[model samples]
Target: MPERPILVFDVNETLLDLDALRPAFDRIFDDPGAMRLWFANLVTYSEALTLSGAYVPFTDIGGAVLRMLAATRDITISDADGAELTERFGSMPPHPEVPAALRRLRDHGFRLFTLTNNTLEVSERQLERAGVIDLFERRFSVETVRRHKPAPEVYQGVAAALEADPGDICMIACHVWDTIGAAAAGWQSALILREGNAPLDVGPQPDYIGQDLDAVADRLIERYGGRGPDRGRTMPPLLD
Candidate 1:
C-alpha cells in the first residue's frame, strides 16, 4: 500500500469518458464535433466566470453553453433537447481501462477521492453509472466552495475536506489545466494524456504523465505502493 497523500481524481474526462456523449451531440446537432465544441466552451466560460468572481452551478453553465453554441450556429434546439445534453452528462461510462486501473489503485491501499467542477449530485450519479462508486471514499465538488477548478480555492478546499496538507494530495486528471491548478496549489499531480488532450506549455509541469489510467496506476504503484503508510513525502515537481 502506498503511504501518505490522497489520490484526488478529476471526474469528467478523467475517470468518466466525455467522448461517449458524441452520439448525443450527433443526434441533437447532427455534428459529432458539437460535443467537443460544447465541452470546450463550457470549460472556457466556467473559468471565465471564476476569474471574474462570478458563480453558477456547473450543470446550469453546461446547459447555458449549449444554448449559446446553438445560437452561434443558428441552430434552434428545444428545451428538452438542451436538457438532454447535460442530463446524459452524469451517466457516462468509464473509459476501457478505468475500472481495472481504479481497482489496482484501490488494492494498492491509497486513499481515493474525486474533486470535480461539478455538483455533488451529478458527480455521484456519474461515478455510479460508471460502476466505480465503491472504489472512492468520497466525491467532492467545487460547488460546495462555489468555485470552479484552476482557482486555488477548489484544490485547497479538497485538502481541507480531506484534513490533509495540500502537499499530501495527488491530483490526477487528463486536463493540463487541472493538473497545473493542483500543482500551483502545492499538490502532487499526474497528467493522464488521453487522446485529443495535451498538456499546456504554460504553468508548472505535472509530476507524472501517462497514456491512460492504467499507465498512470502503474507508475503510482511503482513509486508509492507498499511503504506501509509511513512514506512521508516531497513536493517535487515532475518535468514535462
Candidate 2:
C-alpha cells in the first residue's frame, strides 16, 4: 500500500473554489483585481493569528479581508455587501473533479476526512453547498486546534482524531507549506495542482502530484491496491 494509508484533504483551494465570490467582490470594489488582493491578505492574517497564538473564525477573517481591501484600495463597501461576501465563502463550489474522485476513494476503501483552516461552520456549509457533503467523513477545523496549516499540531491533530499514525496519513493540499509540514510530520503528501500553488522539497517531495483530485486518486490506487482491512469502514464523525 502507499505509505500514507489514511487520506486527509485541505478544503478551500485544494477542493472547493471560492470563485463564486468573484462577482461579489467585483461589485463591491469595482475591480476584479481587488478580490485577489483581498484573499491574499486573508491568508496572511490567518497565518499571523496562528503564529500569534490567537484564533478567529473564518467569518471574522472574511470581514477582516473586506476591511483590509477597502482601506488599501480607498474604496467603500456597504455593510450588505460585506455580509453577502461573508456568506458567499460558505457557498463555494467543489472543483469539477472532486465529487467523482472522492467517491472513487471511498469505493476503493480509503478513509477520508477534511483538514481546513476554515471554521467548522464555514467548511461544513461549503461542502454542503458543493453537493459533496457525503464525500468527507469528517470536517476538521483549526478553530478547535487553535493553529493553522504548516503547523505540525494542525496536521498531527488530524492523525490523532482518526487514530492513524502520521506516517500512515496522507495530506492532500495545494499549498507547499502544508505539504512540507505534513512531510515533516511523516505523512505522505499529494499536491492537488491548482493555479498559483507551489511545491515543497521535503523528503523527496509529494508522493503524488496531480492536476486534480481524480488524477491524484488514480496515482493512489496505482500505488496502493486500495482494498484494505476495512473495505467498508463506517463514516466517521458524520456517523457519530
Candidate 3:
C-alpha cells in the first residue's frame, strides 16, 4: 500500500472499453475505420474546445463524432444508430482483469478513485453493467471541469477532490496523452498496455508500465511493499 493516497484511474478508455462500438460504426458508415476516425476526431475537437475556453459536455463529443463519421464516409448515419453507439458506450463492461486487480489494491489498503471525462449517468450505468461499482471510493467526472483528458485543470480537479496532492495520485490508463496530462499536472502515471494502443513517447515515461491492471498491482506491491504503507520516491521518466 502507498503510505500516501493514490487515486488510480481514467474511466472511458481506461476502465470501460468503448471499442464495442467499432463494428456498429462499420455497419453504419460502410467503413471499417469509422470508429477509429471518430474517436480520433472526438479527442481532437474536445481538446480544441477546452483550449479555446469553450465548455462542451462530454456527451456532445459523442454527437460530434457521429456527425464527423457521417461526413467522412459519405453515409447517412441514422439517429437510431448514433444512439445505439452511445448506448454501447453507456453499457460498456470492464476489461477482464480490472476487477480483480482493483480488489487487490484495495485489500492492500490503497485508496482508490476514478477520474474521467464521462458524464455522471453514463459512467454509473457502465460501471453497474461491469459490476465493479464497489471498487472506487469516489468517481471524479470532468463534467465538473467541462474539459477533456490531457488537460492540467481536469487532472487538478481530480486531485483537489481527493485532498490528495497531484504527486500522490497516479494516473493509470491505456492512453499516452492522458498520462501525459497527469504528469504535466505533477501526478505519478502508468500505462496499461492494451491491444492497439501504441507505446507512449512522453518526456516523463510513466512511473510504471504493465500488461494489465493485475500486473500493475503486482508492480505496485513491489515498489511500495505489501506489508506496510510507504511514502513515494520520485520515479524517473521511463527511457530505454
Candidate 4:
C-alpha cells in the first residue's frame, strides 16, 4: 500500500464558495462578473509578485486587484464598498457538501490540514466562519514562508511543517496550477473540478480528480481508509 498521506487543502475557492462574494460586486458594479474578474486578477498579480520575490498578504493583493480591475472598466467604487467586499470574502461559507466531506475524511483516520495563500489570521477567520475549523488539525499559510502557492517552497514548506514526506502528503485543491505544483514537488494531488475550473494539459496530471469535495473524499477513503494494519476494518458509507 502507498503511504497514508496527510491531506492538505487549499482554502479559497476549493473548499469555500467564492460566489458568496458576488453580491458585493453586484452592488458595487452592477455586474456580478466583477467578482470573477477581481479574483482572476488577484491571483495573477499575486503569482507575479511571488515570481518577483515580493510578498504581500493575499487579502491585500485582493484589494489592490479590485481597484485595478475597477480602473480598467472605469467603475468607481467607494472605500466602504471595497472594505465591505474584503470583509465579506473573509467570511464566505464553504461550498455545499464540503463540511460533511471533511468530517468523513477526518472520521476515517486521515489527518487534515489547510495550505492556503492567505495569511494565518485570514485563514483562521474564513475557516471559523465556514464552521469547519475544528475538522483540521493545523492550518498552514505561505505567508510564513514568504511565498505564495504554486511556488515549490510553499508546498515543500507545508510538508516540512507537518513532518511528513512530500510523497506522503496529498494536496487537494480546485486549481489546476496548485495540483500540478504539488505533483511536481512529489506530493500526491487531487483536483476538484468545481464549475468554471478544469484540468490543464501542460504538466503532470493530478493523481485524483473529482467534481467536488465529497467526490474526492469518497475516492480517498476508498483507496486509503482500510489499508495496511487496518485491513480488517470496514469503512463507513459516504455521507450523502
**Worst lDDT 10-window in candidate 1:** 227-236
Candidate 2 structure quality by residue, lDDT tens digits, 45-80: 878888898888766886877887798878777888
Which one wins on TM-score?
A: 4
Q: Give the alpha-carbon lDDT of every model.
A: 0.87, 0.81, 0.79, 0.88
Q: In order, how many clashes per candidate?
A: 1, 0, 0, 0
How high is each candidate's TM-score? 0.90, 0.87, 0.89, 0.92
TM-score of 4: 0.92
Worst-scoring 10-residue span by lDDT in model 4 = 226-235
> How far out, in Å, is residue 24 in model 3?
0.6
lDDT of 3 by residue, 72-181 (tens): 65777687887888788887778888888887787676888888777877777778888887888887788888778878889888878778778888888888878888
The regions of model 4 sitting more than 4 angstroms off are 227-240
Identify the runs in model 2 with alpha carbons over 4 angstroms from their true place: 1-4, 200-204, 226-240
lDDT order of candidates, top first = 4, 1, 2, 3
Expressed as tens digits, the lDDT of each residue in 38-155 for candidate 1 is: 8889999999999999999888898889889988889988977866766678788999999888877876677889989989988998898889999998889999889899899999
Give the range where candidate 2 is weakest over 10 consecutive residues by summed lDDT. Answer: 195-204
Q: Report how far residue 181 has shifted in candidate 4, in Å.
A: 1.4
Candidate 4 lDDT (Cα, 0 to 1):
0.88
